[model samples]
Target: MQSQDVAPRPTPASDPVVDVEQAEAALVEHYPRLVRIAYLVLPPGLGRGRRVMTAHALAQRALPRGRAASPVIPAQANGRDGDPGYAFVRLRVLRAALEAGGKRRGLPKRSQLPPLLPQVWGLKLFPRSGGADELALDQQLSALSGPARAAYVLRGLEKLPDGDVRRILTEAGAADADAALRAADRVPARYELLSSPEFDACSLQARPTDLMRRRQHTKAALAAAVAIAVCGALVALPGDGWGPDGAAAPVYAQNPAAEAALDPGRLVRVTGTAWESAARTDFSAWPARGDLVDDDGLLRRALAVWARPGEKVRLSFTPGTQTGGPAGPPQLLYAGTVDNARVVILYDGLRIARYAEPKDGTAGAALDFARVDGASGAEAAAIVLDRADGNVRYLTAPWVKKAAERDLMKPGAGAMDLTVTDGITSPLASPATRAGACTSWNVLQLTDDTGTHVLSDLGELVPARLTTGRPAKEKDATGSQALHAWAPYACSLGAVRSQGVRSVNAWQFAEQELPDGSGTGDWACTRAETWRGDGSRTLAQFHTPGGAYGAVVAKAEGGPACGPRDPHVLAGVLWKSEGGHWYLLAAGSRDTASIRATGGISGSAQGHVLAVRAKEGAQAELEGTLEDGRSISGLR
Candidate 1:
């Protein structure tokens, strides 16, 4: 999904979007779940760009909808006076998602949508726990067309009113939620909604048609902003990371297929640890975008894009001997890879956690192959494995099954394919499409000798600009920058982990620049850094771990630390990753040409920089600062 907004939406209904303060309050407490809802509502087939745009746009639109049910209170309405802020925020988000996903064509400019066919494998439901409320809302609803799924999630999972659900679905371009539900067909049996006594009274009256809807929802955009807290987490790794167990280490262990290393050719291996890859940790980044705001109108972690607390997945791997060797970090390494395994991942509620690849070539090496919440804490996760042969495998945690999947303790439905890249598939190529649209969402569910498994059909997960928002202390009703985001389409997994394949060899051998056709090649790299004031004595580094690379130059000057003990008054860096090593074709730095700050001493330099002008995937570690008192570091 290319990231582009639908022409600004007409704010319909009363103002569901509260003043900045209230919107921010809702964002702090419930934004993550709201994002999850938005994710559910987006059709996965959208490119990362499109998915991101639609989700954010929907959120923008949602903030002001269904508000006829509620109006603004005077000043203290930002939940300061005990307003039902959570309910207000969620309804808007749900409305936005439904509307966004309901688009049958791409953007209006897209003219004709390729089609809405998603690939599916019957194995879909991902129930975190065996309990009743443990719904794999995403997976279940994902298999259905966006409109239908939106209906069920709102009415069934969130328990929204029948009227709201009907209006939401219709506004999203569907005839009605019931009709979308019928299109899914499997949902009724999966949720047993039609026969369940619990839903006996959900008889909703149909709203007017979409044409009439357009007439009703014409209004202005929501007013909100996202402010970011730069000092503690953004400027550098969490303060803890700068000191102890918080640093991002490769945790590299030998690939169990050590023998394959001798075989040459492409001996691919998949490995990682808990809550690490395919997840977001730089919460401090993205705030400058002012996309998602909280009650204080600051940019913040909008939501848990992947794992939430408690959602654990226990991964099963081969048992091997333990030996320790120091590569990046030293630990017990696994001996060999597990074979013909029946790995059962477990989940609790919808929060996914736990899940590890038992071995890494060296034995006793219990490394968390991949994680949802970054390093520690359990959260949601989806697994993918790369066979030495070229194809990929998707696995559902023991408890996490697709939504439409029937029969819990048995193989439900699942599917597999090697063509789709970056979790996206165009309907034009799928036989599942109908007329220029899809008759249904196309995520495949598959059942195998190993229980039910789901190949990652990223085609269904909608990507969006993720951030949290809060109002600024100084009330400015007119200050929210309409939120926006961009989708950097991935051509390949490259140095990055498969979003589906939770784990991959940290260093793909010589994937980094190595001793090749090189003469200190052009310095190439993508980067991020920070700085203080006075004489710009600085620090800087380059990043190329994900394969993004380029030759780069840096310079800085300083003044005084903004405040006492605040060594960094001003700091900033920009860089991107690459499939090949980055090259610092040339480089230089200087603090002599500096200035003075608070104590007459130049401000301290605190920035990072790097260069990978190598041919093979290898580069010695380089770390330093830039001109004008900035601190910089390299990210692997």
Candidate 2:
């Protein structure tokens, strides 16, 4: 039922009419509280930065445009009780905030976009991170509908009674105020948390953008502006008039090389069978396969944007990937319509540039770049075609004969066949989009002439290859033993999202027999290698016998502890046995000759593994000696 079906509560026959000045007074007096309410009521999907800005914008715009009649419903007991001015401004803010979050049939309202006046160009502002309790509350609120969130905020934050909340929600355009109130009741009564810094948009932490990258962009913009001015002067001198290129930056210079790079005809297109006869198989050999490959206008716009993206374009680059124009004409990998956007993939020798625009027009275009300089074999097997609604579609290599989806957490469940049309696989659930506890991870498994290989989406243009075995001798994670070995640590992949991860390898390091005669437990280390050759993450996971999942005992970022360079890992966990006995179980790689523990608990062992009886909740430090006499500390 629509909110209009519910009539607002009746007020006194004579109520004070509120003018713009009175509403402004109430807004200024309760600015912080009102902004907090708006922040809590705004949609969480807009991200913290955007939500903070939108909340302030809505609160600031709460005052009436001109003198107006006060609503029949009176204000609640929120300090400004019975004040018609406060009630009027509060209703205005609530309506606009709800409208901003609600879906509409046409173009978005001004409230949904970034505010024109209050903007921080070189810095990002957001609320400070809170503890787990705040995070849980935020997640719960995020799951609620926009109207439900507003109801909860009104009831908890404004301390409004049920009748007042109903009236406010109805006036704020909730489709069903009763349903929204019912939905809000499901949330735990954590009213005190409503005033915490976690939801306060007035108090925010600011972080500057990448200074070096910003400087580079500034230099490029200045150079482009100068070139555009010269080109304008030349055009004014009178020759042929140049027309506008849709959604692309103006031509920066009139040089042969630069002009060729932007020419649609100059884009390199590999034949369908090129990979079959090529000496080396990589993205360079993949044939362009998309419906828009011959669309000159689209190709020209894509090429032009890659050369010099306009200010309006949403540009993103993988870590360490240079966001600069190509040196020469780039190879065209694919150009087609994916969902609502037309996508074009171009690859230079060092990087891959993906340009996408709306199918209807080029108004909201985006360009993304990723480094793929030395990718080959399975590493170059798939490129992300599109990501929408927590799902991702992939453009597989031409050599791939079959595509399937496998749940890494359930290695024995087998794989589900996926339809492949023109080298594009059907959309699969992406692990990168998952939040909270990870119960399952879906990975793409592609079968080629050689063997099957698994790849995972890490929120990048390219999916990361998965491998198993010893560090240097890692093989494809397709074998039964390898799959089982990786099953326990599959959820650990969440730690490497958006890190420009190139590949991930899982290696079983050591196993320890339980002291209480329980089954043996396994120890494994998972490492994520990035395309930039650094910032790898290593996790030492412990999988107890019969446990459904592994526990990460230790983790380190940008270290060689669990990598090929230093292929030894030592970690300990306080595990409770079925008999209710506590033990400190420590295990090192096979190469470790001795292990010792100190600090809170003391223990020593001759072999690579050790199990010591210890008290619960005890802390300790571990050190190990390898057979080569090199000393090493435990993974932290």
Candidate 3:
């Protein structure tokens, strides 16, 4: 699995220079995929420094003779483009190794690979999962280290056609290129052909010049001095502004305003809704760091590292009810102890100057806990807690930047943990009880015999219900049992009384139905109501012997019959202004982030068809924006 143990690769019949040229030819074809693989393999960290260096050197050497004269960064190797060349390089390296009689060790046998690479689970077919895709592809190159990751990425994700990956790695390591290529046989067989010069060259050579033209055009256009609105829907919005030299501009926008600007090119972002989107898009894996702790015992050691010779240190801790009375914020104990320790009282954890703990033994401090609102300029905040024996528990001074309060807040909710300490007796660790501290945004997790649901961090269910819950049909209508949805959508039951059904058919929650009834997966139905788009008039009835009549309508064109042939179901649409027309507006999915824009015109479908209308002059505008600035409209 280590880099050193890779299988050896077969040498080309020609000299090393000729072989390098052949490899370059193959590499040029599939370099994009290979670069992606490399990034996946050489994950950021000190661990990858050597490997990154190794891969870069190899890539430099693999450049074809003429191309080397003016070495330009491969378009595929750019960070924004996902460095697919690394993936292709991985494929090529593995292939070269296989042909060179490299050890077939570590690679899952063909049988094992099929199961390991199950299309349903392993492929991550979701269109938005480029990060996940990178993870999945790199998972295969587990045995190899940083360089191997680069190599595999080039061949696999980038689908590079040649053993240039092996050449690159070998060249970087200053080892025999043929032997190094052979060593890559440690990878699986599926990736072997990916590196073969013949295979890679064929693919590269066969690629149409038109594609090259398009790629070059895109690069040039994106790099151009001006921003051209290619199309309203496809226009590339510069992040901050156009870069000085035509590189992709970094766009910066915030909140509801920036919600609509998410586009194909603005992949990694740092501010506003773009921040959340970027976090979701770029971070395929979870954080590996540990939780933040403010224990005084730990703080003492932390202080040794954080304290400056002349600089003052402040320790903060929250007092619990068991501390007998208000010690103020639990931070008083740490302050008192630091006072006793004779450290300079330059500031308190609240960043307050010269504050004193209450003298009446009121158990807690009277100082406000909000003093350190934004005092993160310091390296660490020293903290101390009281022990049962009256001895200072310990101290902990965590790095301020990484220890920001935001780190403590849980996702989809918030939490505040304050430890009560009475500089006098052992501070009760459990005094930190949940009381008025609970906020509306706070999450209350409730699990019972039936199912589990989370109450919003905010104590009010009305807000959670209003935001996450469905609108009630009526007083007599069944109230929606709260359904938990990690995704944007969930399947819930809906019903209209027979009388109500006469006017608007309210379909009950049925089991999931696949696009094609033939058999696949079912969709989660959140809203199923019968309404016409004419903005007026409700239907009186449906079953009138003539295939049912009313404001309700069926697909303008009936879809395929019940069978396995159809891969997906038809997307539902809304009737537009035109007659007998239903335009495809959106693709439905449980996850809002996964929903694709089907557009008003695509395939055979058009606009929405109404079943019935609520009344005359009834119109609604829904609030949701597509990746483009275009707003998705329907309900107001």
Clashing pairs in 2: none
Model 1 TM-score is 0.27
Instruction: Report the C-alpha displacement of residue 151, candidate 3, in angstroms.
Output: 10
Residue 259 of model 1, lDDT score: 30
lDDT of each: 0.28, 0.80, 0.25
TM-scores for all candidates: the values are 0.27, 0.66, 0.23
- Candidate 2: where is the Cα deviation over 4 Å? 1-255
Per-residue lDDT of candidate 3, residues 1-636 (tens digit): 001112224233222333343345346543433332332443333222222332333333334355421111111011212223322343444333232222236764331121222113211111101111223333455555545544544444343345655555554442454443344456653442232211111111110123466778878978653434445424555557444666755585344323312221221112223323332221111111112122333333222212221112122211110111111221212223333222211222223222223233212222111122222211122222221211122222221111111111123332233232221112212111111111111222222222322321111001011112222331111123222221112101111111101111122211222222223221222222211111111111111111111111112112221111211111222322223332222232121222223222223212222122122212222223333334332210
Residues 1-636, candidate 2: write the lDDT tens digits: 000101123232222366675576568656877787888988999988888888888998887566543211111112254556677777778888899888866887888777785799898777644333466789999999989998888877666778878877887788899999999999997765665556767756555566789999999999999899988788677566656687876677467887788889999999999999998789999999999999999999998888877755656666678877888899999999988789999999889888998889997687877889899888889998887655779999999999999999898999999999999999998876543235788999999888999999876789999999898899999978989999878877866766678999999999889888878889899999989998889988888777766776777889787788888889887777778877778899999999998877788999899888777656678899999999988876
Worst 10 residues of 1 by lDDT: 297-306
Q: Mark the 10 consecutive residues where model 2 has the least summed lDDT.
A: 1-10
Whole-model alpha-carbon lDDT for candidate 1? 0.28
- Candidate with the larger TM-score of 1 and 3: 1
